[model samples]
Target: MTDRASIIAVLSALAIAAGGAALGTAGQVPQPAGDAPIIIAQATGAQATGPSAANTFNRLMKRPGSEPNIQPSKDGIHDPANPGTALLQWPSEAFAGFPRTNDGNRVDWVKTLAAGLIRPWTELEDPEAEPFLMDLTIVRQVKGSMPNVVYPHLEHTQWLDCTNCHDEIFVPEKGANQISMAGILLGQKCGICHGRVAFPISDCRRCHSQPKTAEELRQLSEKSSWAKQ
Candidate 1:
């Protein structure tokens, strides 16, 4: 395999390991010196210089008329392509299986789930669905205009238990999670779990960190994103 492919493979393995460890046993995987040693960190330590905290998007601060959940189609969200409300909302509640909003088109997402919703997974918990409740297309809320990559969620999930990330770090839908860079820098949302448990954002390369190839960059571009503006 090419070097980039190798790197990707290793990184994938690390995520599986970390997330699995956190999920498989009791909820307490040893942290990696504040930031776990995912392959991204293996590339460099620049992440230590960036935002070490993670934040869940808060709905109260949402811009008026913003899309509010994942599975946007379900919530009647129209065109997240524009920067308006799209940027302010959590990317989860709109997911297909996430949970429907009180409006009847949305889903109860991570934040809602955490705030207190008790639904089991459709995968391991239930044989009626796939391994995960939310699909990549739905779960990933990356923006195209941002300079950063889609948050290293899959990777971080490796070390962090689902409960640590989901339902807390961010809600499945927009606005409900309450993640803000300002709040994250202060230790909320993604920061709440990542700052001390998963790899700290102190390293610029961890989240904003990039692959060593143009192809990888382009590939990431096609995925979910919030940097499009």
Candidate 2:
């Protein structure tokens, strides 16, 4: 009799659970307090204007810009920068394996190698500060392929403003910009400036001396923000 009672109780509990699940699936159960509202609709390919549409719902997720609301009626959102440190990160043999970047320099690879063995991705290129006196493209220190960190002076000056790379972004190169692509891209040379203000070095060929396509040329062009790091 006790075994039969236990079996009956288990069956009753299971029946109750099934009924609750059915109600929940039918969208009849009320959501707990403080949860985001649920959306029930089919997503479309093209644009959709109605509130129930997925596009409109996605717009709700996007936060507007930080600027003050000029017109209360306008519901524009501000876009936030990508996640990753504001500071740039470049390739290191300790991380990428085999060797450091192809551009040979006077960097001390022994300590860098040691650090890499202990912490595979630990070592980064922080080149020594010697007097750089040459006109070369500036490179950032982020990770990417295809001349990742490259910058030319005359062209950048054409599109950017004076304050774009003054005392803030880079120290004046003899009142004229002069740095090497190797150091900058490595984050030790020209990255001293472009890494912060100009577009990140992760986007390669944007400032390379040799660009094969028009789109790439455009990517190197001045963006709206001065600080895109």
Candidate 3:
């Protein structure tokens, strides 16, 4: 095998092993300190580096989209390009199983699954649960054209307990943490989970869930000006 192919094979093996551990332990696999080993592999070409070398080795060992011949089905199963296969087995090819939205972008899996699979609060033990139904909109503009983000606790809570985030990665109070794309890229804030195990940060629209209309932008600007007073 060529060096690149060898590298990819090794990486794939690591990913499968890590995926197994994550599944066995209910997704509690340990994280690497400093830069994640995958970042190092992408940067330094997989040479040994410090104590993280073995951790990185184990971590690296542990750790796309688009187009024709792919179709999204309501049943969540797609006819694989290769016949006789059960399902598309790789994460890179997962988009083939979902429908596109009106704007022609792939549907966000979290939203799609949460809509179909999650039970409504009224069906749960406590219909009126404490910390009652709080959702937040992160309105900071990272760029002039980027959309504002809508974070729904409703979706996240279905899978993760509150202690997963509260007072640890994030404070419960609003505006307490200064979140930035730069910090996230370095594995801080949302980056702690995202880009590591969760959906990658590359899909900008996933978190930037709400695109603003021109009138809405104008109204938001007006509100900001008032808040500055």
Q: TM-score each candidate.
A: 0.28, 0.22, 0.41
Winner on TM-score (2 vs 3): 3
* Candidate lDDT (C-alpha), each: 0.47, 0.43, 0.58
- Tens-digit lDDT track for model 2 on 17-130? 897688763223343343444443335444546454543443323122212212222213212253432233332322444334322321223344435443323123643322
Ranking by lDDT: 3, 1, 2
Clashing pairs in 3: 14-61, 14-62
* Model 1 Cα lDDT, one tens digit per residue, 1-229: 2345457767977887898788883334344452323322222323456554233233244232234333443244446565565445445633545545343223433444544454435446565543323324223233433344445444344234556566655676654764456777788776764455444555434455433356656766667464474
lDDT at 144, model 1: 39
Q: Which tens-of-lDDT digit does each residue in 66-155 have in candidate 3?
A: 232333431135645446455434432654556444322344546656555333454467865633344554454444446877777775
Model 2, residue 67: what's the lDDT?
Answer: 20
Alpha-carbon shift of residue 139 in model 3 (angstroms): 5.3
lDDT of 1: 0.47
